[model samples]
Target: MRATLIEVAPRDGFQPIAPFIPTNEKVAFVEAAHAAGLRRIEIGSFVNPKAVPQLRDTAEVLRRTAGLEGLDAQVLVPNARGVALALEAGARHIAYVVSASEAHNRSNVRRDVASSIAEYGEIVSGLPAGVRLRLNLATSFDCPFDGRMAEGLVLSRLEALLAHHEDVEVGLCDTTGRADPDHVFSLASACLARFGEWTRWVFHGHDTYGLGLANVAAAWRAGITAFDAAFGGLGGCPFAPGATGNVATEDVAWMFARMGVNTGVDLDALVRLAARAASLPGAAPGGRVRAALLGACATT
Candidate 1:
């Protein structure tokens, strides 16, 4: 089995940290991720600095790392302004995020779900030639404010978003990390069946409940070929109380390796990078592979 693991440590992983990570360090991490055979990476987001001060220097980071060979550097854009800033920074791949739950959407972007969908249309119409778009339905399975999202609501929102554009990638995000494996599998299966041919599918999960990897496996069984993970599991949604970091990239790579699946990531190199990320001051890191690997070496 072959899978594509889109590294999100630079963007999702670093976003929640209170202290600003130096721009140079952010570029280095992206370079290291490329060296480790990760072709796609979410380097950062172009959002209001006041909202996410951690990613305020996204333009500079994007400029510095966008030229890395074979690197499909992606940036998150929440609105037309974000899209403008990202494109100004020479980003060709943009991930637009909107929550499935109305309440969560309001908290996340200060807009209702319908308003976001309208904005999605405007964004698609305004994107320049050759730019790629990836739609991330945050809270697709569960919402921090609304609790477990009804499958119908998720499907309807997805259908509405896809109606705007078809040539794009879609991510069903477990924003609060409270989603179960059964929910992940069922939703993934449903989305794939309904809109499988319309766009590419990706799974974004978190380890808050110790079900991150289990949820990943469940998505894979439902035929999801691509996933999003943060190295050392450094992430959390500021708006989602009690949510933890994303599923660790190293852990995902380890799990795939053991299952005879090829993720094309150099585990040793990834572990080294994860260690550096975990050591960052003020970073709340999670995940077991790094510690488990260190322990195994200690015993030997």
Candidate 2:
């Protein structure tokens, strides 16, 4: 089966926590992930230090991992400045996040989603030779302030972004972990039917409901393959309260491995990476392999 795994442990995994994750340690995590055969990583993010102190040294983190072999590093860009910072830091690929909810977008970025989308287009306009871009439409499954998101609404916004973007990938986010298997199948099916040709369809599912793996299977069944997972399930949304972990990278790899799909990722090495991941300052340790590895270390 065709499958591509985008690791988000570095950026999404450490950002929501309280303490500072040393840049060296972050670099180690990235290095270890590469050894485990993970090629694509959302390595860091460009945002205000005051907002996400854990990733305050984004520039340093990216610089530290500048020469890793067999790894593709990416970061989350909130706007044009973030994009510029990413470009300056030698990132060839970046992911832009704009919440699907207007209120969430304003509360998070001080602008509505439309404004952010336009800004993403502007960021694209000024792109250099080889850098690539992907946009994450967060809250695609559901929104907090706004209840029950309509599929039509998500597609409409998606259509708008696609109209403006020619070479961008779109990752539909299950921000709060409220999505189920049926939901994933329907959404992925519709998304592939409509946008698969023009853009790559990536899914960001959370383990909040213990269905993150199940949802991944749903997307796979729907003929969608690209996914974003956290190292040992490291990250969570800062805006969504009670939302704790992303699907663990090791767990997802294991799942696909057993199903005869190729993720080009090594589960045991990734499980070892989970040990270092759990040590990241204030990291909540939500993924299964991460907790298990750390627990074993404690028992030993």
Candidate 3:
């Protein structure tokens, strides 16, 4: 089966940067991702403008790219209010993040695990039917403040969320880049065993330790087909210390191509897009493929 790679750079990558990417530039970024054959792209978050000024123009950005062909626009929502705003802005796919680590969850959203779950439940109940919900279990592999996560604890959180909302899809996120291939497979296997054929899980990893691709491969073997990657490896958890950018979209595309799995992304076009992102202030291409492609083009 073909895999899905969701491009989260316009939201996740630009969130931690100091300066706001102009709204037009943000739209251009989305257009580039769409042109490169990415069907799903996270345009921005619908949170407090003061909290994350970079994404304040999410509505405008979404408005600009709303009617693109074969494009699915996703936006992150922190609460019911955010979800309301996202829907008002015509967002069809919405994502919510809750950390598996209690300390990290409290730090990220100012809510304890139980409280966040309750709030998320309320948010889900209030959503209008037909809106796709994506729940990210952040800090799934390890917590910067809490160290490694117990597999049982992760499974328990998953069970708790599923209990409240059975229709939701979940993403296992390595929020602090602490996941290795072995640990990733073990946790994925545990989740698979307990959930038994619930395939709506996505692997979201950061490359802080340079093990992003390895962990991705492990998850793929564990039967995960959906992934969250950023252009140029440009993302980090603003609340999670020591976190780095996500696995580069182009890099993953290259790896999957070699492995005979199709991602439907144009590797060469993605490299060009990454190069455009690297030109923006406070941005840099952290993935290897863009550099490699540049070198190859230079020699040719």
- Point to the candidate with the largest TM-score: 1
Per residue, candidate 3 scores C-alpha lDDT tens digits across 1-300 of: 578999999998889887778898999999989999999999999988877888899999999998899888999987778888999989989999889999998888878999888888888788788888999999998999999999889999988888877766789999998899999999987877777454378899899989999999999999888899998999898889878898999989999999999999999999999988877788744778889889999999
**Candidate 2 minimal-lDDT segment of 10 residues:** 285-294
TM-score of each: 0.98, 0.94, 0.97
* Candidate 2 ranges beyond 4 A from true positions: 289-300
Model 2, position 242: C-alpha lDDT score:
64
Query: Model 1 off-target regions past 4 Å?
Result: none
Model 2 clash count equals 1
> Model 1 over residues 1-300: C-alpha lDDT tens digits?
799999998989999999889999999999999998999999999989998999999889888886789889999988888999888889999999999999999999999899999999999998899999999999998898889999999999998999989878999999999989999999999999988486999999999999999999999999999999999999999888899999999999999999999999999999989999999999989999999997898899
RMSD of 3: 1.2
lDDT of each: 0.93, 0.83, 0.89
List, residue by residue over 1-300, the lDDT tens digit for candidate 2.
768999997888888878777778788888888888888988889998888888888888788887888677889988888887888788888888898888778767889888988887787788887888888998888776775678888888888888887567889898888889998899889988887466888899899878988998898898878999998677887877667789888888878888999988877788877876776667777666556655777899
Clash totals for all candidate models: 0, 1, 0
The full ranking of all candidates by TM-score, starting with the best, is 1, 3, 2
Name the top lDDT candidate: 1
Candidate 2 vs candidate 3, lDDT winner? 3
lDDT of 2 at 179: 88
